[model samples]
Target: MNDTDNEITTDESESTDSEAIAALTVRVVGPAGEPIEGAIVRGEGDGVEFGGETDADGTYVEEEADTSTYTIEVDHGEYEAATVEYTHDDDGEVTVELASPVAVAELSVRVVDSAGEPIAGASVDAEGRPHDAGIPLEFSGETDSEGVYRDTVYENAYAITVDHEEYHPETVEYGHDGDGGPTVSLEPIEGGVPGASRITVAVVDESGSPIEGAEVIGRGTPHEADIPLQFRGETNSNGRHPDVVYHNDYRIQADHPDYTGEIVRHTHDGPADVAVELESGPERIPVAITAIHPDTGGAIEGAAVRLVRTSGPDSVTADAETGSDGAALLEVEAGEYNVLVADDIDLTLVETEYTVAVGDDPVQTSFEAVTEPDDCVLTVEVVDGETGSPIEGARVQADVRAENIDDMGLAAGEADGNGIAEIQGWCGEWEPAIGSEGYWPADPGRLDVAGNDALTVELEPRE
Candidate 1:
């Protein structure tokens, strides 16, 4: 009985060992479904140690392999290594597709400051995987002297993160293609330096009224490192703007639609305050004046013109003399102005002064000159013809015609309490027409004002 038991136990041990061994077959193929030859195949785990190479048929058969779980590894000289976790049952079969090695592409990144200047010694970490299924890619390095970080990676989309000691950390998404690399900008942390300063700007109109919604820009002078410092902000409801700056010089400019733009410069030794006063109106413009001859209607040269501001702020008088082309230009602020024109020759202008409202656009007007005409005066009296009483509040007009002079006709004057109307600047024939309120009109026919100085007319009372 003892001998029989011993033989049975030995037989059972042999059977267990035979069951633990398995016949495993591995097939390798190219990406295009073509058979791969001479590809190394290895299997380990579960007491299965197997190593072999694929034949011309991309087939590797291991007749003796443990029937359990295994980690399969495949490698090829012209392809990337592939790893897979597989389970080997009885005579299990597994296939692996080897992909051709991918060529690495170049990726570059640049970091800049607010002034569009490069920043060096920045840490950069870029990592990504193929959009579909492929090998992963990663790169890590610091920027060079030119603020450039360069590396070679697979052509794929990557997320890049940049960090600096004095600035804020930033992350950006980038895609690696054949084109140029991407650029990343970092903002400096405010008050990061020991001597950081601040500034306040206030914008106001000519009337000392606060101007809101104004655009304020502060540009700092370049430093020794040539990095620019700039900031932009808008005025609040109180017409105040604040910014952080270094101990340097800065140019502040303010602009608004309802006021003229203003620029101011300031040196920032410490906490500083600046005031920008803007004019409330259109900008100054050039006014063009042309002098013309009244008799011949031709341009007259050598005429002096003056523009005096009458409605706006007091400004220096602007004077200009007409050139040979009878044109004179004067720079005048936007306001109401009284324009005076004169010349060496006889300036017999009916009116020597003109009132003009100047705005932003160029203004053009003509001034005419004529030969002086002789001055004459005439007096007329109006009365009630029915009642033989003097008529008050009567209007008298005279039309004059003279040779070698322009015909002038205008209203003379209204009758005074004594019923007398006097007209001046009459030179030749006079035609008088008189009328009173609530009375019939009267005509004294025609009279020569050069010879006569007084006349009488009667207005019949309305029934």
Candidate 2:
């Protein structure tokens, strides 16, 4: 008999005194105790080798063997190889259980939205196989409240699909070769103006009657690479305006001749519908004003008119613009107001105080121009800071610095071939700035038309 653990004596010459043992049985099974067929079982000891394939019941019996210990090795095409040490006292059988390689590893998946917020109750499905001939593997479950799904899979590559009611469905291929798991971000169904972009407006009177020909204007904050939220149009005969393809938070204004003006605040997540109501009464008075040139005695076109409430509990300001007939209309509350006409070509600033008592007729007045065409003009010359050469096609803008005006944007002018930009229709102190295509913007400073009519600005090129 061999003394080593793996060696079993097979010599018949020395085995006359000792009786031979019964057959040694080896059973191969999976980790879950299921039978594993076609597994190769081998044993070697004492210069004698014995091996055989497991039957349908995963059983392999050695009919002849001595009373010695043998090292058995079991191998399967779908599982990790396992080895066992067995001592044949000629009694019980040895069961070898093989484990899959994937059982030792773990996998995870997470689902979220475009805003990086987790989405719960999402369905996650995955399918894969351990090998070509191995058993198929699958995982189907819903994500937890934290939007995480965890499981163990037998394959290196898997196809995963995720679905949600409020979001678009997504599919991705995940591999277990890397460190971290996969994370999927799904787009929302009602995404924004770019996705479902439309805005609807409706105008009505106090008694819920439709008000036709009402002007509607909407403005919103600015953002890069997005559609600017600015639109203006008149309501149709049905008191409804055409859809505006924009989405954002906006301040909307609705105005009509026989009704009071209305302002509404709204937000558009996807598509939005808004309604505005105007009040009509004797408290709202209509005022008409015309502009005429003093020298030519003709009408002046395109002059901005402003009415500042000078005698009221709350300070209010209203504005309008003259049309081709040099006439504009304003609907306001009955009170004393400071009528201010802005400067334009051949016109100077006109400021006057007027009172509108209760139950008065529609007031009509005329504002005469006070300056020549070249009286209040500013000429700006743009040049390169380093080269001292004139720069053509530069843009110059001046904003009024008066305390009564809410919006300071007066007008803009472009430089001519001689690098000179002339801006007219500005009075008193103002702020001026210049910009060009290939150069950095010039520093903003003060420009008073009453003191200087010409100035020079320098621009530096970008590095």
Candidate 3:
């Protein structure tokens, strides 16, 4: 038989003494020479036909068969069918070898400690590293009492990791070997390396009550060099936070909403003790300020003014835009501050640092615009259209629009005895039409002041 290298030996149970058809024993073997039990075997010949299946030993016997050549076919689901012919003159023996269709890779792992003893409760993993970011293939198995883990995987590079609570983990690559399973060895750590200790901080308010969810920042300072400390964390329900830091000098800062912040310095030789109590926040009061033109002594609308705190619990800034009446409200804290004005197209007011103390009803203060040399002088004259005479004490208005500026300016004034109203230094395009108390523009189009040194427009009283 091609399957068995040794000569087929006959057993006494298969011998037949009487002159009758003897039995033939057929056995099936796999590609690895292992018996393929439960495989179907059929014997067919001219005027001879018998069908049976392999037993537990991959053997099938046919009783009372004639002495003639018969085609024996053996088939198993895992292997291809193999056929062979045998002449059954006496008790005969046959073995057929089947070929394997495909080959697949298998991986098995054994985990052990440094003492060469198997360790239970150890985790083992085999992961496949893909070519691209297409989800990687991963397989996981745990060690049993014998400390063994096995899994079937495709052909690819795999990484293996072994972990245990009391042992230092062992990580290695365990794939691409030719059908041989790899074993990993993990060492038990006697004691882990010494780690840094945490600096505990507790934040409280002026009333000695803990403030939960406060922002706490710790910085290592007092260094001989110019290095800066950078660390930030937040408090828990107990208003206490612990941060890993070195034993040195540090500055602890804490702050919470609706409360003033505090900064304290402490030295850390051993366990550090740092506690800070913050004062209450300042009381803020609302005050309004007005902006007036330095030359015209009139309210200048659209002036960019901001009030900044000079000294207080916290530096504060409040911004306001002037309405048509040239008035802006400021939410000023009880502290000294300087009112700031930006020079724009509408007015050439220099950045003035005029300081003022905000008190209760500090009254309405006025800021005058300081004109520059490149100011656009726009003048408006209000007069009666029928009489062609000067309209004295009439409200004259001028609106200037400039490109590349966030705010446009409106300058308003009353007509003089000669029906003249004047404005200075407004840049870019402007619609200069005279508007008095009872008079309309009563004109067609505005003055084209694209590059003009002086722009003058007249107004007429409405019917």
Candidate 4:
């Protein structure tokens, strides 16, 4: 009996002294305290053999681990890895808390027009650094019928810009506040023409009734001998001209030449109209003269009195003048005159300029004038600098200096998308100038007429 008892005691002692290996029991669970299955658990420590997988109960027991600090890594798909550090307690359990992954936040944006109406089919995009730099983490969305756009983005700060054709682009910076996220509002763009101020002009006849077809001209400040003018459309039958004029005070002049010329101070504000009256003036007559002899340069009698009117297209030649000494003289009504001196012998002629004021009687004037036709045409293009592209809606101007001509001006033209522009009615030696916002003033002064049919000008971009 004593021997049997000693044998049992020795067996118990052998089992206790054989080995004192440290063991650890780890558990893997989700944030809800539910056991997560299929979780991979790895243990790292001195004498620790790493190998683990959570069972149905999300529990993994690591046996034979060293009695030192051991770290447990539990990973499940989509859920962030849970790490737990502990000193194995030879025979106990170490519990670990693993935080669940955060879900992505969604943003909803709405874009509206200036009238507070929802704008559909508008593009919305994140604007700053990471986004504008082509980082994929940035988000963008398009507005739907309800003007609402939705996008799921990681929690972060972002700058946003909204664009639509009719309205100006709007921009703002937004950040997540941890509560779902706030709605972003975008303002609409203004009208197509930038900085186009409105101007209303009243067109009135002698009786104050709006006269239709009367043109309104708004001239800009003069720069380098040329003042830019915007031509407003003719008055409607109602006599009111609601036009979009450039923002500038203008020297407004109204003319129906058969009528009295009216000048008034005008701004880009409300309707402005000046009254004009028509009066009949005496008919204008033309005068002509002739030179005689090829070498003597003397006037020949009976050279014929040929008078011509220089106002309209048709040249009205009436009386002719023969040379008395070396030149011929002809009589005509006073006002403005362009007298031509010609002869039967050599047809050597010249045009003389003279202005006849009131009380100036019809008189004789002589000249040794030469005839010359203009041989050059000028072409110009206008463009915007911000976008190295053409500006379709700019105006081009040309100033011509012709002998005996007062206010010889041409019509204003609108540029095409390619910034190409042309004018047909300009003649003589003239200076060409092009202007537009975002572009520099064209080189002013003079452009020589050298038999070239066309002149190409590239306007410098504005700073």
TM-scores of all predicted structures: 0.29, 0.30, 0.31, 0.23
- Tell me which residue pairs clash in candidate 1: 22-65
User: Candidate 3: what lDDT?
Assistant: 0.69
| Per-residue alpha-carbon lDDT of candidate 1 for residues 206-279, written as tens digits (9 for 90 to 100) | 87888899999988886532234787898899898988777777888999866779999988888877889998
**Which of 2 and 3 is ahead in TM-score?**
3
The regions of model 3 sitting more than 4 angstroms off are 1-104, 132-136, 177-180, 192-202, 215-463
lDDT agreement with native, every candidate: 0.78, 0.75, 0.69, 0.57
Each candidate structure's count of clashing pairs: 1, 0, 3, 21
Q: What is the lDDT of residue 84 in candidate 4?
A: 77
**Candidate closer to the true structure by lDDT (higher is better), 2 or 3:** 2
| Per-residue C-alpha lDDT of model 3 across residues 144-195, encoded as one tens digit per residue | 8988886554456778888876677888886554565677898776553223
* lDDT (tens digit, per residue) of candidate 2 on 166-234: 677788988765445799998876643243367878999998888899999988766332355688999
Model 4 residue 18 CA deviation in Å:
99
lDDT of 4 by residue, 369-433 (tens): 33233434455556554555777766776666544233454524557787877654435657666
| lDDT score for residue 114 of model 4 | 56
Give the Å shift of residue 90 in candidate 1.
Answer: 29
Best model number under TM-score? 3
**What TM-score does model 3 achieve against the real structure?**
0.31
